[model samples]
Target: MTSAQICIMIAIIVYLIGMIYIGFRCSKKNNSTDDFYLGGRKLGPFVTAMSAEASDMSSWLLMGLPGVAYLTGISDAGWTAIGLAAGTYINWLIVAKRIRRYTHTCNNSITIPSFFSNRYRDEKKMLQVIAAIFIVIFFIPYTASGFAACGKLFSSLFGVKYLTAMIISAIVIVAYTTLGGFLAASTTDFIQSIIMSVALIVVLIFGVETAGGIGAVIHNASELPGYLSMTLSYDVNTGKAAPYSALTIVSTAAWGLGYFGMPHILLRFMAIEDEKKLKLSRRVATIWVVISLFVAVFIGVIGYTMSKVGALEMLTGSNSETIIVKISALLSQHGVIFALLAGVILAGILASTMSTSDSQLLAASSAVSSDILGAFRKDSSNKNGSMAAARITLLVISVVAAFIARNPDSSVFAIVSFAWAGFGAAFGPVVLFSLFWKRTNKWGALAGMVCGGSMVFIWKYLIRPLGGIWNIYELLPAFLIACAAIVIVSLLTPKPSKEIEEEFDRVAQMK
Candidate 1:
């Protein structure tokens, strides 16, 4: 390898070692399943907020969003960011405190499935089983997308084989996660969030400067038809811009709805040391999200400008996602110090990927071991056995996710979108109603889950292909269908028991 390549590899290696060290240090706290799965509800406000957003952003922030902006201009990407930012703020404001309090009240539930099952006082464990199954189903692909990003990063930067790079990435994430569980994942995610933010700002400032400043970049982009318009899409075939409709904008913004149902993010809320601090966490998270998203979108705009000026080469189609990598590589051309900084920024890509992957892996493993397997066994209270089962399940899930990511042609954005819809539609309505609406019964929850989950598939594969208005995002339609189902079913069925209603009232009245 060249000296530049060696430097980049060393920087990445050091970062990986640091992650593993954190995991090892935290592993000593894993005496029970609660500690492993929920960090014993001991995370601080800053760590809680930063880690949650870091895991939620994933590699999509650095790669997918920028890629879309690079190819289609800011309209699509900007609306999506607006949607996500709004969602992040609203979720923290409305949902975080209640969920944290309710989870503790309901048998100290350690996982989402357990919380749902406990909330309804389900003795048969049907809700827990179904929730766990859905988590595994949706999370596998979500996790796979992160692995795919690793493959792309390595293959593009170091000339590594795609599969080989993907495997190595999977192994590193699995190692730290399996060793330390939730505590390890959250701690490292906090550090990664800082790295990701710094990388975005540094690269954005340098990229704009290289492209002849922000004014020049904006001028060049505006010259292209519809490139800067929020209400038009550029059509490559006719070399013209087409009107963007309200439906399309709504669809793009609906990405925010995904936040309510994301198990990985919700776990952060439940793990915070004190529910009162969530207000502080909310502000921190919102500020970080807004700044990071703005920088990310601009990085794509800068990449386009730099490519046009011959300072960087533009990648087309799905390959356009490498625009961030291209920008980082160009920065390395300046000198030795800049080359090392480029390596650090490249490590930011790995940070984004590993942060999300570890969370997904941990969530999936907890679903299988603590929620699924623990439900069936009489020795479910055995902390040692549960912890061992969690590690083993994590390994199995990592292998399955790695296999799914083996396809060289997979698009990170597409995979994440589908999984995002699945979770949003399936759990978002249930979570909202379960917390705020006293009328939601077990039957209603079940109906909502089924309708929401099924509608995503039906809409995406069946109705969406018909085009026209049906082309709207599946999450919006599926989410509405799920909500409607919950209301109708709950009204038709018998009211929740007095005990359930009383508990709900108690939680609602909490400060």
Candidate 2:
């Protein structure tokens, strides 16, 4: 390897070592699954805010969003960002404090599945079982996208086997997460969010200068047909402007809907030390998300310009997702300092994946060990074995995710989009109604989960493939279906029990 490559590798190694050290350090505090899964509800505002957003963004923010812009222009990426920014704010504004309060109020439920089961007073535990099932279903692909992103980063930048790099990334993530669980994941996410921010800023500045600055970036972008237009996309194959319909814009923007159901992100709300502090967390998270999304999208524009100026190689298809990595790789060629900065940039890519992966692993682990197995255990009072069971489940899930992500050709954006739709459709409506609608019963939540989860597959594979307007994103229709199911099912079924109703009213009154 060149000196530049060596320097970048060293910087990444140091960052990885530090992350592992944190896991080991935090492991001392995890005495039981409660601590492991929920950090004993001890997260402060800053950690809670940053960790939630960091995990939520994953590699999609750094790689996927920029890639969308790099390949298709601003229409898809911009609208999605707009949708996500609004979703982030609205979710924080309304849902965060409520769920935080409700989770604590309803038997201190630690996981989303558990919260649903606990929230509705599901006596047979069917809600928890089904919810956990969906978590595993959607989260496997979701987590795999993170692993796939890491593999792409390493293999594209260096000459290592994609599978090898993927495994190493998965192992490191599993190591830290299995060792320390929630605290380790959250702490690392908070740190990773900072790294992600720094990486974005560094790349933006260096990439812009390398590409001949902001004016040049805009000018070059404008030269391509529909490249800078929100209502059109430059079709590289046809070399013509393709109409970006209003319906398509709305469908793409519906990404915001997924925020309501994101298990890992919701857990942050539940784990916070104080509900009142969530207002502060909301502000921080919103501002950060808005700024991050803008920069991430614009980086693609900068990347396009950079390619034109010979600072970066032109990328196509899934390789477009590596735009940030390409920029960082180019940065490394400038010298030792630049190489180290490139390392930091590269680590940011890892951080984006790791931050999300660790949180997801924890969430999925809880879904199995705590929500599924723990519920079925005859001796539920035995806390001693729970942590071991949780860790084992965590390892199994990580391995499954790694295996599924073994395909180096897998598109990070495609995986994330599908998984995001799954979670949003399946859990989004259920979560909102459960928290906000006290009249919502277990039957309604169950129906909503099943309907939403099923519709995503049906729509994506069956309906959306029909071409024309049917090509709309599955999340919008699935989310709507799920919401309708919840409302219609809730009204058709018997109302919640008095005790459950009182609990909702009580939580609603919480300061």
Compose the digit string of candidate 1's lDDT tens values, residues 129-201. Answer: 8989999999988899899889889988988899999999888899899999999999999999999987898
Clashing pairs in 1: none
User: Cα deviation in Å at residue 260, candidate 1?
Assistant: 0.5
Weakest ten-residue segment in model 1 by summed lDDT: 233-242
lDDT digits (tens) for residues 377-410 of candidate 2:
8786667788889999999998898988999987
Top candidate on TM-score is 1
Q: What is the C-alpha RMSD of each candidate to the true structure, in Å?
A: 0.9, 1.1
TM-score of each: 0.99, 0.98
lDDT of 1: 0.92
